[model samples]
Target: MSSPPAVPVTLAEIARLAGVGRAAVSNWRRRHSTFPPRIGGTDVSPHFSLADVEEWLRSNKKLGKATSREWLWPRFEALGDRNETGLAIAVVGRLLAAGEGDDGGPDDVGSGAVRAAVELGQREGPSDILTFLLRRWLDTYVRQITTTPEPLADLMADLALWVRESIEGEPREDVVTVLDPACGVGHLLAAAATAVPAALNRPAALLGCDRDPVLTALSDVRLALLPRPGTLPPMPVIASGDSLRADPLIGTQADMVLCNPPSNERDWGYEDLATDARWVHGMPPRTEPELAWVQHCLARLRPGGSAVLLLPPTVAARKAGRRIRGSLLRTGALRAVVALPPGAAAPHSVSLHLWVLRRSVAGETPSGPEELLLVDAAARFPRSETRENGPEWSELGAFIRSVVGASGGRAAGGARNGATAEDADTTAWATVVPVIDLLDDEVDLTPGRHIMSAPGHAGPRLTDSWNEVRELLDGLQTERARLAALDLTSGAADQPNATVGELLRAGALSLRSGRHPTEAVAPEPQHARIPLLTLSDLLLDGSPSGWTNPDDAVVAEPGDVVVVGIAREFSAWVHEGPPMAVGPQVHVLRADPQVLDHWFLAGSLKAPANARHAGTHASSSSRIDVRRLQVRRLSLPEQQHYSEVFRHLAAFERLVERLGIVARKLGQDLGDELAAGRLAHGK
Candidate 1:
């Protein structure tokens, strides 16, 4: 037989490969008798042979547009279930690595799973094929099986590579080795492999160890997939065993260590390894499992090498871990404590800390002048965060850079004076707290407390606030007069009214929603980038609130009526700004300029009748039924008049909002000045 066409696929997979919907695939099966029949699987989700589906798609003119990963995932799904899938993939990788070259095929592996996989190896080297397979595995199965979020792996890798350079200094010829003792699926290890070449212009030897055998096998395959430069320190080594108890790579020391070890495990070999050599900092209390992992990471690093460990916030000030924290700081091993936002990692509700550590180089002491960097990045997450999505990647990248830059100054022996709240804008958000201050009774390492005792607005004068309030009041009075002058009553004119669905059907307006073809990951703010208009931006300010790739989002044209689809209060705006993309919670209604005025449609949509029909909910996050909204149809002349009046009223409302902000700030400043006795009893 011809290898049984190894890759098995489902109807849904067929649709994805063909870049169409499942219904279309069903239609094809019913209408075209030539379509492939189900080979396996339940009645609800029937499976088909991958090769047959592709052939069918080709014969029917539909098989040439999918990404390589999309084409490979179904093949892996056909191999076996999730548990044995990784092993089956490992076997195929081993076969290709051994130079079998797809010769043995199903005869060599004794299964249908290896047939297409061997062909894949023949086409795109075994390493590349394995990388694609591993990524699919991680995206689909890793989160449900592991606690570490995928993004955190990238962050830890970046921090580790950055610290390695800081510790080793520049212009090196030797290959650097990076290790991850608790490497889960080798995320940090993969990151390190990529970062070493991109940052330091050198090859890297990646070392990883995990107690779980399956993870070890998975990590080994992933490490083999990493791209290699010119010859480095031996091939990437991943060992399976408890890294803390009997380290498989004990004699070897890595130049940098990066890890996200499991925490809160009670039986993490504490009884058998009480006096292990790794606990040179202090004997970790039995309750603090994270400290044990911390010591293991520190012990694996060579002298002057840096290690960045992601730990729970409790490790910084826990009663049991306090002694180790103080010891690490006193010896200058602990360089910085960065408090990340809650959603930065998995277990998404807990805000974790990144502890930047350096093994004690000979003759280095952090007695008095060596201040530890403490960064308050707890508020670093984007304000537009939802319960489902965590922090933004670009923002997290910026935070990591800021933390590294702040600590880099200290590591290079560059000391500077303390910055008050007045000079905060000129300096980074991090503060350098002396080691002596941290060696207090509690040994607290929370970033918010040690960094800057005062809030950002500590020094602005009441006079300045009052002047702004005065200016805003003047503008508001003028706008109020303008609002009063407009003819305010609805005209007694006969007109037909229609729902938004009717207008859509009549071709008077086109409603467009869903992602654009060229959409990409959004860029971070604080950089010069195109603004993406979110629902919050629509409801609060008339401007954009976030950044996105111009291609990844749909742009709002000048005449388009934008509606907020998820909010306690409904809002609609006519886009008058430069081209901006619509965010997730927004819908764009492009009106025919010849038939309707954009401003008039928006005003009518905002009215009580239309707003009530749009959708009402106790939770603002509930989506609005924008298509069900009603609009009043009027003569073009009447619409133009109403549009003109609505434009003036909107401008007036904006001025009033500005006036409110100024009034609130003036009240706050007045209270602060009075409390400080700066204007006691009006002098």
Candidate 2:
């Protein structure tokens, strides 16, 4: 019997293949009778046969130059099950790694997928192809997969390596082993392996274990394919099992451990492993599985070995884990707690903590009172409008390293003097707290509590606050004057109007909808080259907060008018900065300056009447039908005049918003300082 047809693709995929917006695809389906019919998927997101669609596109000369890697993803996705998709990817990895010919395999993955993988592998090589497929797969199931962000992973790896070097002195020439007990997709393990500096002359052996066999297989493939130095050790040892319960790497201690363990897991073998020897600190309470992972990491470390764990902030202050927290402090296992800004990882709303721990060496005792370094970087979180990736990881990482290094120097009673002037400046954020003080009733290790209470910590200045408020008031007054200068007069009774569709047909404007980045590819504040203006940015009237790849970006020029395609608060504005990628569900309209002014078009698109007539739903939030939106036809001079007025109005609104923010901050600062007796009214 003939093999079943290849996996169908969604409309979004077809649009991607055609190198056009989704709206363009929708238009083609509606206007062209020969458009392929939906073969599968729901009406909301219909899927079409890849063969039929490709044939149609080729016949119409609409197909874009797409790579084999791009074509292979849909077929792999067509496998219908996520498990099968993962298996198919893993099989491809194995085939490429083994350099085997594509014969039909026992796995349910179709022959077409295997063939496509072979073609992609030949063109891009094994490593590139596997990495691409893995990224796509992760993006496809982003909500389900929880991999560590790249910057955070690098920081964790660097911190672990630094701690190891500090405690053990010089790096050993032998193969240094690294372990990740909860290695999801091997990001942490891969990071650790690559983090070993070549100057150390030490090759790394990576060990990873996870509960999911599929993830374990993928991690194995990922680690196996990583470009290693010439001195690299054998393929990484990746195991499939619950690391906490089964202890797959039992009795196997590594020189360094890095893990982003699963948080808030009550069913993490708590009852069965009550008497587990790994619980050296204390039996982790049922509500505190993170504490269990912490102990497990410590247990698996060789003498003086270090582990860096990305944990939830709650673990530092939770009542249930106080005993374990105190014990860790007393034993000098937990060395530092660094508070990362929100959006550093999964569950983007809450700030996360990095717990740096080092297993004590045999016969080692505290030379003096033990100290726990606390770095509070939460206040350094980038504002919503600032284009930054979390915080500058390098600066933050260096600050943490300095504090830890200094503490180590002090503990060793070296010739190095105490905190320097620069260190004093950082005291507002980083402070070394006494472990004895932390072993209180609550045993709270929250970084903010200690950092804020540290001597010489600088609070907000009253003079600076008042000056900011004064500046805001002056700006607001200037904007109000500019807005008031706009001359207003009644217009003629009748005015001619044209719909956006008519303007498009008349060659007065070109319209395109923004493409959403794949689920796996998120916009970053730094590193990425193209700035992405998202829907939230539009609604909040803020600058672009993230960036994406240039290849996948639909850049809007300075004069283009961008409108929110779907929202309760519909808005349209003329872009005025550098070219930026327009995010998903945003309509970018480029007006021919000779025929239509961009500012006029933007202001007209925001007209309340247009929203009513062009909206697809009557609810508060609605999808805008851009083609149906009407714009009043006006002379170029009149358009320019109106544009000037609209510009001034927009400026006025921004000033008003800034004024409110400044006023509120000033009020809050005054109230807080006065209440705390830190400020007094002067005569």
Candidate 3:
């Protein structure tokens, strides 16, 4: 009756099984490598038995199994071509990974690997840029751009993703449509689509319109290109054109409006729309880029619709622009102004704010006086980054979704990702300051400035990371002090340049590397833990390398000389911090106080002629390469030169420290106020 499963699958099925493109399968035979060999497909298509390959791949993944098309494919060719087909991606993963070891890089399942797997899809086809874009899109799909909206664009996207996802929390009527008038490439629309999956029973009927034809065209295509085929239809007609000037989607009343319009597009057709109906709250001043988008988004939405847009910080407190901004806030339609990080955008890195707006008739609204929900994610995510990443998006999204309370449903909803209020103890750090707090400070809505660094994380526990950061900070502080003391003791010019051997003889340099097996240091995709340094650590004085950097491990302490190219500036004081790691680029130099004071050496690098001469030999760029340091004119008494130049270096170091402290204090004060929620009190 039933019988065994059919034997050889089609070439297409083979390709699918391998997770490789059809051509990749063809290449396997051409390469004549050890891939499983089953035969069957259009034009003598070859295949392998499923049982044979799956076992082999599992074994390979466990070991350092690097494979090549040459190494693994022929195995398939040897076996009788054959079978297995289903709607699952797992079937193909095994065959695809079967011959993947020879590349040498890890076959680890990750974004990089994902990119590599997709790279094969174009083995026998496609252009580079398209491939580039494809890989980037795949990366983007795996990630949520960010939840923390710092720049005007960031805030806008955040509000958009938030509202789109919020629909499922409350089972609203499936008919409500959401629109983003000034959409740039449909980022918001796509995010909305994902957040409100059709399975939720209430799909977000996502729509958007942008003035830029190019951006709009791309959005149309992107909406169509779902990761998996045949799931949902491409998004409905997303209009292209200036929404303010032309009514492209005329007579359409959207249930929700999300827009992050251009902040400063000089010519906005302002003169033509003086009597625009959307300007119910306030008209746009020549300077305010947010005003036009604000009115346009509002006009597009029906009564009770919600519109969230990001505005410049200047709008909140700028005296001249205050009338419009103030009036809107007073109107209560301005639900929130969440401040963001300064470097959140390109061209300019300035703090921005998000303004959440609700559409309601003058008299009919919720119970409380107009209130605002301010979130300062600026401090919650990666501090050094201009824009937040995936984890940040997930975290920030949770805040907005939970805070809004999913009114079409209930308040206190669950966190977006795996996070909970208890995950990092974040709820304790969450500050719900009032609009008046912002107004009191004249609305200086800088998230970093307002949100204070709390004692601990919110919900999840991060004890290990917290402790590590504390240790790092302590090290920096200790190093700073040692450098300061040396500045006063050795002055700047006490150090003179010298080679690693000289520093070693004088107890300033030491060489450390694996002695027995140099081969043990074979390059991993990521470099060794040893840090690479540059001369940027020292200014004026010839800088040493391998002193301090994130990746650097301090194997050699302060006094140990990192021998690089040459020895010079031996007399310069240890102006740089202590116990720093040296890069191969720079040899760490440990100095003997009895032989030469570091202060005196600090000034010796200033001799322009010597500086240039040393740099030429050392291969230093804008910053010096300590490894390049070589023994130049050692004829001069090094200590004498070091002593001469010490004072100037010390003065510079002290001044920098003072300036840093002041800047930090100002930032900390603002963060403190925002975190306490004192700034977020009633409007």
Candidate 4:
């Protein structure tokens, strides 16, 4: 093989091979307890064999395989294996980091209010920023451990415990290996490794993979750092390369594979690799790479090996994709499908789905057209307010745990027998609806269909919610009517003014955009400091939010307002007193103090009329900021009104913010009660 890697690899060497930043290598060690041992028992500069660590990464390279099998079919896709060492180079060179923009901030439009938040966080006690960062980072570590959807950290940790329970219940005789193909930075791998001892009293066979060199390397560092019981392997297997195109660890069969593949890709690089091997079921449509990933994962596993994947609804019932669907059902590889909440995947707006696949038996056994085990998990999750960091993921994990533990409830419609003697004999509580109802046109996989969407509270029913919604709508309509009666067109509030649309067409005010910065972490300049507002720094409601850990390097000026054209989408909001500079992509509109009021500019940018001019948003790691934004115009008088409106809107938004905070408290408390069974009927 590769010449018995010298001694053990050094973390620095590993970091280089993995393509990560040096700091990231250290962070990986600090985060993962089971990282390779230090050469001299020194945590700092600890070293391990490159070959040994590479194997460890390969062992966990299950994720890469799943990703490969899904898109390329039979053919193996090779993603550039990477970690953080050379990440800076790749991000700068290949990714074209500037071509794409970030998704815009939170959807809510509380601009002035958000500005206040960023200012407050910046001005607040140092502890707030430090505490935020530490907690967030720790949560990220916990999330990596579970390798699950973006579940809340605590909930994901618990769900990981449940995964162990499910696997343990299956009666494993030896060490168990779990693979996550799209292991973004090794969340599931870390969890699988950690859970092995707790759930099955054995060491974990946690492994993972990804197409991005950055992610794979990051995964390596994360897996390397975990503390292991002396008996366990020192590192987790994490490799870089397209999991679908080529196998990182050829001739390896894993017991369990888990993943959340990218929803859809335009050029998954499939056109170049036709006539490949992985596609035993059928060729996947370019539009439906997810299907290929599903089949590829099935091909990778040994018989009786199980896998879980997050999917979109189309995989279940789309007519264009019926061939693979029919094949999977007839082959009986499909185990179960769980419907998740609509907004389950935050970064991606698509409705999320979960699918479980098991390899079919060789002989024509009792298993025939098996009905997939379907769990409508949409309504089971705790409300968003209660989700600690991310509630959607928290509830999803808990529900997954419950379903996995549930006994054989239903069989696919084509099964030879109604229920196998072994299955019928199980005592675990579960229900199995026939597959016929879930088939064909009836097969929409939204969780709302299968999962019971019952509210935990005993007091109110659906009718109450309906009434409240109506009441709220009625109140809003009344308020609108009242405002319409104000005769604003003739009043001082309403003047002969041009909309922001007109100003842009005429070019009275100036809209300038700064160049995109080459480096994300650059040395602080000793010039007049300006608040650099990336889309990320601003929350959806137009609040200037900071990372849990604050980066004091970027500051703001007095009238600096940020309009983000990142992955999140576009909207402009003024920063509070602290002056901030706009990121390179975000267009900075400089107005003479007399010409354009800062608040008015922010209001005009947010005005619904100007949204169309913002241009179509694209789907990429970075967002798109169109040049059109830099050419907008607005009259001085109209700008003044826009500014005034922002002032009033800001106050109302703050009130809503308080109400939300209170609501979140109630939701969290309610979740605790419900999950603990305190909210059960008659309790």
Candidate 5:
């Protein structure tokens, strides 16, 4: 019936359908005579007909007991193309929003995909279905699509709304309008839509524009499905086409704007739009596409309206954009420049910036001394095990609020005089530098530059430093004395050795690799509970910086040896506390106390010979083939003796490491205080 649905399924998808792994699917194709043949796709990733796979699965009783919603995704994903799939998803959203008995629904409601979507929508709510589908789609095309993370989107929305509230006072009856010119999948707009009504207690008219038609359609559907409080707001206006060239929403102005536009785009209509009117500051050079977006967002704002743009860090200090940066500062449009830590959003390795701007009302002069807030909140992020988890928003948000509040006070009145060195020290992370101070030849708007530590009074700080130094020196001497007592001697002894693979086969130890978190299932720092030990922690001998859900965790119990699977320097740690999750690129080796000593195994894994032999590459940076690593074959008594020596050596190494860290910190502090004339030599 219905021509077998003609949808293609990859081996991975087939494995998912059968509730098995890719290897199982491969085995089936090899061993089973009735297994489906490849209809299309490459040899590396062959595609099979979904109908054929389903028939074979049902005949063999291998089909997973999955709901209709689960089945809908693979079929939906197999649509004509990416754009078509996006459009189909959008159509499904529209159909879901239409509800039952709505004759106004799309005419193609009888289509299999549409029918399945309708059934799923009825079983679950329309909002949940759309959210589920969109999340999966985004996850599937993570590298291809550039959507803002929800937390970062929420932060941008909150920042814009808070700034608006601060400037305009109490909530007004007028409906606030918010615009995002490069809305992408409309995360920012959706965030703003939710935040504006809640904060302002009034309706919000949302506007969005993106170059992709499918994205525009999807955005419209997404905004429509959002649950609003009290009275319903007007339907959002999502326009298609490049906002820079075609100017879809040209004449529109909004109370607030939030955007995370594409960065470093070269052909963003520079030549054709040279004399365009949006360049209130100055014409942006071809290389400064982010600056163009900055001006565009500013232009879209109503007088005194606020905007927040997530931009690349280079936009703050690039030489080409210096003129525009200065103009924005001089005109008092640029309110603040906050530098977010790396992993805040896409391009996770580089620290991105949030440039907060406000449109100046006609004929408004500078109130008190004009100043711009510069906040470098990089250090404020919660201690994360990996860079991918991003910052803890609550702490970061509070820090920004405090900085902004302090800056507001400084703006009304001139900079405070007779401020103590302690007060100056506190402002090192956040400073409200005068606009005049920033209008130099470079006109660099980098937050780090303006927020550098200022010379402070050394009275109390110098006293504290002396106390710290004395304590560190005493501890260093104690560690050195302990090290001297060891009287260590090194010698090589030939012995029979067995590879880790042999040990595993002999049931001497159990080896398990850490599970890598998927984008959808990855634990956020806020939601995580169990401590997660990462490769960085293993290498540096530091405490756990990551966290994860206990159910998905690969926990290492006490006496288990955790080894870094990939590193320039091979290292291993003996777990000493409660069970903890091991993050990606880490291996947990649980040794049987009767067969092998945990300390001995850990120490053996860190040997230079093992590092070279197990490494896959000739260079220092290489992945370790843990199975290939050889361990000495020794009696249990001999192993215990070696373990004791290894344990003491490890403790001695840790002490030396601490001594080095403390000594360096004390040296830097003393050097800084003395050089700044805050401290004098004691007689």
Candidate 6:
């Protein structure tokens, strides 16, 4: 009556499903005579049915946790061979798409995975099961094979969709066609589909082609699941083939072409297909296969339609790609080249460039036939090691606008780091480079080279630097005097106090420590990413500086006192920003306004003596037992008075910090000017 023992799983998976170690599963196999016998797989990695293992573990009181769809994926992976594994996954996807009782059409051809798929469908429902399976596959297999990182996929999709919108200029149409020649798991298509309902023209037809059959199938299923408004578009057309070798949809031309094609592919039919018509721009060199993809994408677009392709920076400047690059620039097919930060995509540490291209029609010549837009957007990426390389959407949106809004090869522009008045005429970071300048001997289209060549505001005057230095000196003296006058000496020498743990037991304050960070899981992707407050981030800028997921950890609210675990001595800081998740080595204390002051708690806890007494730890893994630290007992008014003095001391610290920054910046600028013979000590 019941399904045949689910799917056969390996000992490792059994351990995972039971939330135990592999050794525990092995011990059970040896000690428990009633344990499931090997149903399949090698002696070293024997497999057992899920139903039998579950029953045995339950009877023996060893089943530790509930099994979910995540635990089921490893069963598919245990199917023995790599190709067989992929086939099993594909069979499952096909079975899911065919609906519960439909027998899975042609692709289902009957296998262990097929039967397991049906059983999974019955247990978890087709939609939920398939979503989890695909998500797990995306996190593992797809991530391993795909060139684009998950975040870059969203970015590329948005940019491509923007180009499509710009070209398809809206009044309102019920149907729109968009295509991706090399769609990988359909991330770009899925992102584009989310924009359909609000679009003036909804995406009625989605087309894609890829060389990998498995990915092509996955892409099809992923696109099919995207929510559609009113009526669904004709089921998406996803073909399996090298899009460049032979166009699968020969007569079809999409309004927009979005592609992140494989780069640096040497065997890209360059030698065999030397006379290919797609190379209308120029004959692509053997080393520069991305240019071939660029032309292929352009060929897929309707007249005046735009295409966005993700390419390597080498495509912009490599010697072999110059001819094709020059042809694109000369024909005005290439509109803009925006450089993204390194690590923007997986497997490539070098910066990537987004080449925005448009096909010219009878009456439409690009705004600047002799010029191209080049933007150095690498500045928008965070330099912190703990942060995700996901480009900020707002910043990317600004980049899109800047690229599209520029006219006559000129647009109002300014520096990313606050431009001076003199340099306000031309844009900062983004520039419009003339074609003639780019066509020189090397034909280097790298955005940095051209964008950085534009003149910036003149260096600071010697008199101005001297005047600012003198002003800082005056303020430094004033702050020093105020620091000396602080009345900390008036505090009671013998105050009654209790340990932080004791205060917490008496309901005077609440203490919480964050989850110790591990590499086990990642936060769900977020569009408006917020910086997580790590100990290093707190120490450096006194602000949250790394990405945080709202669901993953406890967040510190405005009045919480955050403490670092491994400080040289005890250290604490009052959080001042919006609520943010605290990192591993951090703890937060929320004080009761009536009983304790946050500044007072933080100041006393950060005191050197209190820090050392908490524990004597080694230099390698130092820590502070914050609960054992003592807090002074003071009435609300007295606490408020001392808190005010603490606030002044904090301000003094900040003033000194600013003084150092200004002094260093001034000296550096002066030294540079002096080296250039633009400044002297006398005047």
Using lDDT, give the best candidate's number.
2
Clashing pairs in 5: 385-545, 385-546
Residue-level lDDT of model 6, residues 1-683, one tens digit each, is 33333467778677767887677889988998888999987997687877788788888898777555645675665554444666566666666666644354343223545666658766776657666666655544432466455555555554554544544343344666778899977766675565544443465578999888878887787677566677677778899888888778767777677788887789988877799877898888889889999999888887766677888888888887788888888888887787886556644345678888878776655443777878776743433322343455555545544454442222322122122334322354667888988888788988878753222222434466567667767776776777788767676699997898999999989988976432112223333234466666555655553454443456788989988777462478788877777777788899998888899888778777787777556763578788888878788888887787677677777667777766776676556545556544675
Error of 2 at 656 (Å): 2.2
lDDT ranking, high to low:
2, 5, 1, 6, 4, 3
lDDT of model 6, residue 575: 80
**Model 5, 1-683: lDDT tens per residue?**
23435678888777767778777999999999899999999997798987788899999999987655667787677775677778778888887877752223344322556667767888888888888778767655565678888878877887776566556343364788999999888999998887787666788899999998888889999998898888888889999989899879999988999999999899999999999999989999999999999999998888879899999999989999999998998888888888887667776656789998888876678542388888887644523423446666655655565566455543211111112223322365777788889999999988877654456633455577567667656765765676577754653567889999999999999999987543222223332246677766656546664555443457788889988877475678798987778877788999988899999999888887897788888566678999998899998898887787787678767756765765665576567666667654689
Better of 3 and 4 by lDDT: 4
Candidates 1 and 5 compared by TM-score, better number: 5
Estimate TM-scores for all models: 0.65, 0.77, 0.50, 0.50, 0.75, 0.61
- Candidate 2 clashes between residue pairs 3 or more apart in a chain or in different chains: 139-520
Which candidate should be chosen as best, given TM-score against the real structure?
2
Model 1 regions more than 4 Å off: 1-8, 39-44, 67-69, 102-110, 145-158, 161-173, 197-202, 366-369, 382-390, 410-428, 453-683
Question: Candidate 4 at residue 249, lDDT?
Answer: 56
lDDT of 6 at 304: 65
Query: Which lDDT value does model 6 have at 164?
Result: 48
Model 5 CA deviation exceeding 4 Å by range: 3-85, 100-114, 168-173, 366-369, 382-388, 409-428, 452-492, 500-568, 572-599, 612-628, 644-676, 680-683
- Give the clash count for model 6: 2
Which 10 residues in a row give candidate 5 its minimum summed lDDT? 412-421
What lDDT tens digits, residue by residue, belong to model 3 across residues 448-508?
Answer: 4454445443212244434444654565565566555654444444445575345556564
Question: What's model 3's overall lDDT?
Answer: 0.47
lDDT per residue for candidate 2 within 1-683, as digits (tens), equals 55567468877788778878777899999999999999887897788888889899999999888766777778887886667788778877878877775767544336678777866787689889888888777766666777897778877877776576656454464888899998988889877777764424577899999998888888888788888867759789999889889978997888899999999888999889999999998999999999999999999998888899999999999999999999999988998898887667776546789999998886778532378888877754434422344556656555555555555553221112122334533556677888888989999999888764223232545577678778877877887888776655678747989999999999999998998754323333322256777877666645665566544567787889988878486778888887788787888999999999888899889888898889988676678899989888899999998888888777777778877876776687566555556654689
Give lDDT for model 6: 0.68
Backbone clashes counted, model 5: 2
**Residue 616 displacement (Å), model 2:** 17
What C-alpha lDDT does candidate 4 achieve relative to the native structure? Answer: 0.50
